[model samples]
Target chain A: MTDYTPYVAAVYGLALLVYGGYTLRWHASYKKLERQLASQSQESP
Target chain B: MNILKKIQPLVGLASLIVLAVGLWYVYQAPADFQQGGAVRILYIHVPSAKMALASYIFLTVASVLYLWKRHEGADILAEAAASVGAAFTVVTLASGSIWGKPMWGTWWAWDARLTSMLVLLILYKGLMVLRHSLDDPVKGARATAILAIVGAVDLPIIHYSVVWWRTLHQPPSLAAGANADIHISGPLLPPLLILSAAFILMGLYMVTVKARQIEASRHLDALEAARLHHDD
Candidate 1:
């Protein structure tokens, strides 16, 4: 049997790394925006 | 609950299912193929290409909606789709090249599929640059929408590139009702299909989230501008 371990690992690894990074970035930005909005609202009141 | 608000979660759930299915398929692929171990790349390359195509199609639709409805949501969707599509397109090209080097004996070729894909990357990048150059959001949206509509002409060309020109790249192997020479049997097909579905769902979900972010950012900017005017 041809060993497909390396190819499989590469594919999954890259997908997880890239997509995971994106998810993290999205969460961070969302939190930052929420904080900013909260601060602005507080200032207004 | 608003229908539009639910789109993101629905897409997220669908994408998760797809990712699970893809994992199952990749583990079960047959070992008898000529490409042997490296055939696993198919799962990624095919799905990424499909996503790239789908992104451009989505952009085209959003462009039309922007022109007709003048809706900010549509413009934001187009921008988000274009950005994600460009990333997927790059992955497709890179993975395809890696697979081709071992199988086709070259890292690059003048094949129609390859050339057309490169053109798509360029067009997407150009549109993104155009969007960022303008200070006015409305003006940027209008200009980018027009560019997107014009650039959509390349979509059909990319789709038909293999048919129109004699190239090194093989014709599509997954056409409906034809499985004569294609080796998409057993666990491979399921995972590949599942991954494609997952990518599409994930792409849509990301686009929706990005669109909302853009809208919120614009609102914040407008509020800031108004406050500055009041202070003046």
Candidate 2:
């Protein structure tokens, strides 16, 4: 059988890149916002 | 919400672990008699497609709730799900195209199933743009919610496209009764199901994180507005 490993790898790799990239992006943004909120609350109170 | 925050990390970790297991199962499964190693693409393709559909459904429901109840959280949830759903749709289309190049001898076809899926991606993008395009947040939310509700008609069309017309796409392997034209064996089904579960967990984790971010940003906006009011 002809090797279709490259095609399979492309599919999996694309999925990882998209899902992993989004997760990291969201995590960083959320953490940054959370810190800002915490500091804002502390300053006000 | 606090409970969700506490469990979010656990859910993310579980999804990673489950995905690892699913990949292992896919590695163990033998190549197909006909398609050979190319068949392995189905593991990711099927699950991504399913998750894409599932996310859209979630978005539609959340959109409905937002429209009916006028809850900001539901609007946030709908927006979050739409973003996640868009990501899944991109993956689904990209992976399907990659899989198709070798199997179908072409990158894409203007078939019903494929066209509807593309429309889904377009709707997702449209929702995001509509929400941000307006200066008035309330107006934006209501307009996007209505658009989402209307776009949901595409879901059934996407689902039934295979059976309703002749197309390059095969009937759903997981479909039961007379609709099941493609029959995946018992051994092959497990990896697909496991990966699907993992995708669902991951998608849920992403949605929750996103919703929290949206909430926090809105809170900050309101606080800043109040501070300006105080100064004035």
lDDT of each: 0.73, 0.82
- DockQ, every prediction: 0.45, 0.80
Candidate 1 TM-score for chain A: 0.79
Worst 10 residues of 2 chain B by lDDT: B172-181
Interface C-alpha RMSD, model 2: 1.0
- Write down the TM-score of every candidate: 0.85, 0.89
Worst 10 residues of 1 chain B by lDDT: B173-182
Please write out the lDDT profile of model 2 over residues B99-129, one tens digit for every residue: 7777665788554555677888998999999
- Per-residue alpha-carbon lDDT of model 1 for B122-219, expressed as tens digits? 99999999998999978989999999988898667665865466433445532211122156666557777788788888787767666656656766
Candidate number of the best DockQ: 2
Q: Which sections of candidate 1 miss by over 4 Å?
A: A1-8, B1-4, B158-183
Number of clashes in every candidate structure? 0, 0
Residue-level lDDT for B142 in candidate 1: 95
